[model samples]
Target: MGSRRTFSRRLGVPGRAGVALFAAGLGLMSPFAAAPASAQTADAPAGTWATPPPLGPGDAPPADSGHPDTTYKKKNECVQRSLGQDVKINFRPWGQDYLQLDRAQQIVRAATGSVGGNQKVAVIDTGVTPHPWFQDRVESGGDYVATPDNGAQPGMQDCDGHGTEVAGIIAGNPKDPQVGFIGVAPDARIVSYRQLSENYAKDDSPQQPSAPPSGGTGAPPSGGESQQPPAGGSSNSQLPPSSGGGTGSGSGTAPQQDNKGDSRDLAKQGTAGTLNTLAQIIRGIADTHRAGVINMSVDHCRPGTAPGDIQEGERKVQAAVRYAADNDIVVVAAAGNVSENCPQNDQADPNKPKSIVTPPWFSDDVLSVGAIQEDGGVAPFSVHGPWVGVAAPGTKIVSLDPAEHSNGLANLTIANGNPSPIQGTSFAAPYVAGVAALVRSMFPHMKARDVVKRLKATAQHPAAPGGRDNFVGYGVIDPVAALTANLPGDTGNLSLPKPVVQEAKLPPADGISSTPMIVALAGTGGGVAALLITLFVMHTIRRNRARSSPPTK
Candidate 1:
């Protein structure tokens, strides 16, 4: 009923005690409560605060209760342009000001002035429209959702509005003077890949035949919840923390026990998206040199599986990410938003995450990113995990609209015809991706691993002693510092102070003479005692005199 129902688009936190606590502090409505951005008023009392309700484009209504057939159909169609796909703004969004990108840009401009001019970032999610902000920088890598017409660009059309926004965060450069929000790397190039979309899901009857496509634990946040996937979300195979796992962005609705047989089979056959396609997509990006960095805001989430029971599709994804890393490409992805389907990874042990979201769970090869609010706290909907490499401003998003006609920036998206603000880690991954671009541009010779390490090292680490935590990892990213900070990895990093050698010295000895001290102590004590004795004798004599004279009284 809301904006385009997208499986790749996550909503908010679960409807648990955590949401209630978060709402009580903020004076929000029920966990299930959701409102459009237009519903909020700026005129709340001075001491109070007002904000938009969490908007989840992925929250789908329940599927049919009837026994659905396992032989589901898959098709491809172009995502049509929509009227409310974007909301224009004459001012900058909080994220830009929060990160202070303008100042960072100024600093970099004065030095290398390489604001990603030589960088290319690949966005694998819903397709991106050719927005005005992109100018001539947006490119079509390929499409998994819709079969391209002979002349149409496969990955140029964005129906879900997800990938377009993600790319905007990385490379949008508007011509307008009034709009303050521009891409982090305004000069960088963007390659769009449409790998997932809700619009291309099930139909009562099969229409035109086409090819198929792919693909925290901190506490329960307020808006994220497990809504039924728009297309069938059930999976035939899934594993748990200790054993292994499957791949998808988030988990699907567990089929009810009574309907398990039919629902499970139907889910397996459901044509939502697949990890197999996601794997292929990454390999495609790596092999063709389409981009040096990849932003995958979309992930595969499923119920945990046994420790050693990794699925075939998941193994392929793991191998593909490894392959990318070996080729010296940086992969950045969302940490995931918490909900019933996808549990938070708040466990003390890193490996024993309550839920596993891959590419992210594959921490060594991927730079998993978490979302933080404008206030800098981890977003309530942002799920915590050991794999989180860094955090960025994910809420109160302002970016170019994917609608081909809108050609403007948006702070609000249409959810059920109501204005809803864009908030999710889906957008957060791009911030790091954008920063990665800036880093690679600044240091042309830096390797991919070092780039990942630099971003983490330059990040504002958490309060934890290790400078990292499950919640925010190394902490919120500082792009200005990332561009300018010197590191051990820097070959010319001689700015560090040289070690100073010091002569070892013994403890100071007591120097005063004991004889003088003893004499002074003896003299002082004798004088006091003599004075007391003299006073006692005098008092005795005076008492005797008074006794003789007391007869008269």
Candidate 2:
């Protein structure tokens, strides 16, 4: 490939260009730079390295908010994107059309059936745009990327233009005429948490000089184990772990080729997102009771690393997922997409993917989703792993545009001024989240674990052994089935009324009298009489034959 500009959303989709080499004067390179097989880049967008302008007089957080009052040290700023290709309002996205959400909604009766029916789903990604398609369903949860520093309201700005796309898939409800576009659960309210962003990057200044002289770069491990970047810097590196805590130098919005003749863009966008941050955000969601479901489309990925080498950040994310499940919150995450920095898991054993995408890797507590193309096949870029729970439509995505003060929708994102269809596992995760919201709404008392199981059971299972593979898991999600289907041994959390054992009412079953019963039995005696007569004749013949045939040896 001429320029490897991978733009798939977080293990990312939109707006990434070439590899983000170490900036001058930074005196450090990507931790993966020395890996002959891998490229080093965070999943940030395609912005030139421009630090946010110097902090103004009041830009500093109030002293009461914290203890330290240090000078504002500038870092490499990436001018984030806020615009997307404006699509016609009447246009219907193929993903929603295929899901048949309206049928699911009717069955669930989210708006009309019960009090507090609209389930709250939290989107922990770039902040969601306040698109009109949301119809005031968006709520600001928190902003880790742009907050006290930038003075942007918490969870209100989508600098990377990625979170808005994710949220729209979960709750967008455009009431325009003849519009087929609607969310998996239109009534499900969205709680937006700007947990990560490609706009912000870590300041690995020369003063820190944390990197060793030999540059301490290590290639991904070839062993059958998962890998994730450390918490210090570089984004979640890639999947299996949740959004990484500290991101390294961001990758550009360009496509990179894994081998030869490959056309799918797999460049991950850089963001402030990291695994530890992701873990923190998940726990926060459970603590605050903000939402019943969590959607994480961002992930930290690294080239395969040493066997049995688990990053602390990945463990934290795993704990967070368990916490969410314990608190009855359903957590859904993207099975990270493929890129040069993050290779496919095809070479690994069925259960052991060298590339571990998180919180998806923490599968028991999470519902990891893989991406599928429009034709119902697995998207080539959707990374494969055993943790994947189900698949959803990910290719050629259409969702709310993340631009500021705009109510338009978008089907494509611009990279290097060229429009490419919005596509990625990032988008797919939201689809599952939307379905999860609907399931939560319909079965208000179902346990979070049961909800996860329901999704797997209702999916369009693959033909692979055990009805799943590393790629598509249990297969594509069936929203309608998820909402209404009854499962065997479903005692997980249906919360149905207990069955009451009681004696039957006094009216006895009518029956024939004994005389009539005898007649009924006698009515069938003719066949018996015929059989007896035949037996008598056979006995007479046998007696004569016995007399004639004496003894034969």
Candidate 3:
């Protein structure tokens, strides 16, 4: 059955037609493709040029699908330790872990003379906890969701652990030097926006007596699709009938009783709701003139299959991205999670190539970050297409996990908590976002285009047919090069002088005559005018002096 399944599975671009067309188009259009390798100087590693198979992390296996009636409480437990602030962790081989980051830091430190002093980054994902990793590192960016008043509600906190993991990568600070984590920017502040609601539908609803505590990790993988909460199950009295259309009043709500239903209920797309909330936050940021970066670790793809045109949600997102750019804000989004397929198979219509980050990465204004493996290769599970701006570390990456899944251990707190190694393009995006904040901090007046250009120019190209590959864009981001790279932005308005026409011949003495008439006449007129004015002024002064002297006498 397995052999037949493998044989039956169609791979590569559907047929050779697509490949032939793409190659022909490239030959006719791409100037870089024709440029000689020696002239270009840099290159990606040599490999047979092959279109990587469409891939995705797809559905996790049945064994990994189920979740506990309640989330694991230990996952949320913070481990307090007496370790000092600056300890080196042997998280990986010392040579690999610290060498690159330390070197990069040194370069940035030398360039800027400090970590970002007071720049804020909005982590638009699951809420971050008050850990030392984020100690003195966050401001109360109001929670966007109204029903869930506090961080305890869904979309107010992290339940799946994806957002928390990404946060730590961008800003975690573990106490243990030997076996914990340190973020890319420890001092930079974070504003958490819980994009994914915590009260995601679960399969089982534990009764009052049986309901597990808030911070408990439920039994691992009991069956297919974890326990889901019923739609409109929790506190309907506090929530509006439809969380769409218009803004609802934000009122305080309490912990609702545990009620379980299908997981699909949680998958509802409130594009309007999400965009409205995002707009409000962005407006606030702009109104206050707060210059910072917006870190988006989530992205949806092009919508429309057997239906009408794409939804307004995508448009709203595009507008928000444009708003961020126009307001001098840096917007960063994840390339996306990849299952094993080449392009993701749209659950809506598996037959078409209908997938990539939504609004095509909000019209490419936002920097779309892809995932790279430990070997600096594109992660097998990373979705790659034209939208990719750059690649960053996204493999078995260790970062902050929520307390419910952090497992009472501090070391585990920094480790990838999920079953299949919490690696995705989501984590990679924040690394770049942190770097952007660093760039904005150093070059306060830099625009979005300037930041993007410098990042690409200074990126360390991966070894290959190697300039910018679809998979890794320009290549891994070089923080050191970025900080020191002299990429210039728009320098407002300066006019250049026109070139003078120096003639080979003087034409004639007539040309000289014309020049003499203008010059001599102008000089004589100026001299006569100056003499008359001087005499008149002297006479008037003498008369006034004589009258004043008589009076004085």
Candidate 4:
């Protein structure tokens, strides 16, 4: 893979890359580039990259918004809010209404707790906080963003609420009647992997640095404006005791005002470094053998670029996904929140080849999910394309909230203490992931591909032109059907079907004849007989004349 430039797109935020890394000052190095001969030896780790010096304040890359900022008003409000003279209050959690939770509950009850027993789902996103609703189901895998000198914390800590929300949807306990929030796979276990940094949302100032570094010669580069994180994080609710604080990297800190001279230079380094770090994290996840299904609600987009163009960072991620698939781990990702037809045209460059967002578009092995509304229509912001595997409810999804109000941002209070309603494909992907956990738990013998096939085969088709269309793919997933129905070719044996051989019918013994051939043969015989008769008559006439008077001549 040549080093191709790429962009990221947030799940909920429109028109912005989900995760942006800038290597403006530092040369853009490929995260998966082969190390020099001097750096490698037979004893070294198989996939280790040459370690660069720990980034300092001067080297801190500027953070881009990878996770959606939950502080803002949710795109589509799940809970209805009542307006009083002075106070606004949220009434109830309406996610159940749109999700048709009763149907899912009925299926679970019938199954008698047979679903999601020991199935392990790896959530690769922001860190997930262990909420009371989880009931000790959430497990810490490791933090990939932390370095020894970056003041980063270990374990899964969601400074932004994205990871916790996604985990809640996948495995939050349904037994918590007080909270009234139920996860699709309530019994499933969650393994959290913090692939993104805590300060993923921070942005640098746009103005160029006023001065060069104290010892350096050149002026610092200008920085881009900060964008909001994608959709589907816990609103600015308080972080629970179980929910750890920020990764302790300078993530929570506001952009510096006095360090204008080196801010841009540092921000670019940070951004570029983050990409390399993310690739490493994905590779680590692939190496973990215990993970059954990996839910990645993150998406990358290069605004104004075609979809199929593979970027260097994206190539590394794709390779990681392939590694996971080879290990029998199923990977599910968001289809992105952009409204365009993915892997299609780039109106920005009409003549360029159609390309799609990364990770989800990386391979067929990755199950890419799109968002659908309560009315069984595709979400307005949901990205549509041939790559979408299935659709799930993403609009106004109500899930767990962090207990401590650390950020003091926008917090909506629903039942179960600050549970907020979020909407995006980020939330949609987890729905499928939860169902995938159920399938894996029930059918432990099935391969990853067979599991995905069962899910798609059992999905409920919407009333579209075709049973399956690009907008919703195979339509919204039917959890009950997926769990109970026996799909075609689902037998454990991997043998191919026997070829059906039809016996050929032989022609009649006399031989076959066509009307045109028979007519032509009869015509030829009649012509020959007429010519012979004419010649005989002429010969007879000549003989009679010779005998009468022409005998002498």
Provide TM-scores for the models: 0.65, 0.65, 0.57, 0.56
lDDT of the structure predicted as candidate 1: 0.61
Per-prediction count of colliding residue pairs?
35, 56, 50, 21
What local lDDT does model 2 show for residue 256? 18
Number of clashing residue pairs, candidate 4: 21
Which sections of candidate 2 miss by over 4 Å? Answer: 1-86, 110-117, 148-152, 204-271, 491-553
Best by lDDT: 1
lDDT of each: 0.61, 0.59, 0.47, 0.52
Q: Considering lDDT, which of the candidate structures 2 and 4 is the better prediction for this target?
A: 2
lDDT of 3 by residue, 1-553 (tens): 4544443344333345455655655663442243334213222122211111221344111111111212221112121111111112344422126226666655656756766656778776545554445665655554543223233433334433445555666656554566435667656777766544433332233542232244322211100111111111111222222111000111111111111100111123321124434444555554554547877765554422432233454544555566667777777777765432224423432223345444224424567777777776677656655456777876555554343323211211111112123355766787888788777776777777667656766677644343565566667888777776544343212123556998697555643447778999999999999999999999999999888885544
lDDT string for model 2 (1-553, tens) is 3234442233342334223331311323222112121101111112211011122343211111111111112122221222212334466778877887666777777434831246898998767767777878788887665452344457876655567777877877776757656677676788887665443445445564322221111211000011111111222223121111111122343221121111221122332555655666777778878999989887777555544455666666766777778899988988877765567877634434556566676666778888888788788888877667789988766666555555656554433332345677888888898888777776767888888878887888665544565678777899888776777656534544567999778977577468976887887697789899999999999999999996988
For residues 341-385, could you state the per-residue lDDT of candidate 1 as single tens digits?
666666555445566666676676788888888888888778776
Worst 10 residues of 4 by lDDT: 218-227
lDDT of 4 by residue, 129-167 (tens): 566667788887766543212132343555344567678
Worst 10 residues of 3 by lDDT: 221-230
What candidate 1 gets wrong by more than 4 Å, as runs, is 1-87, 149-151, 202-271, 347-350, 491-553
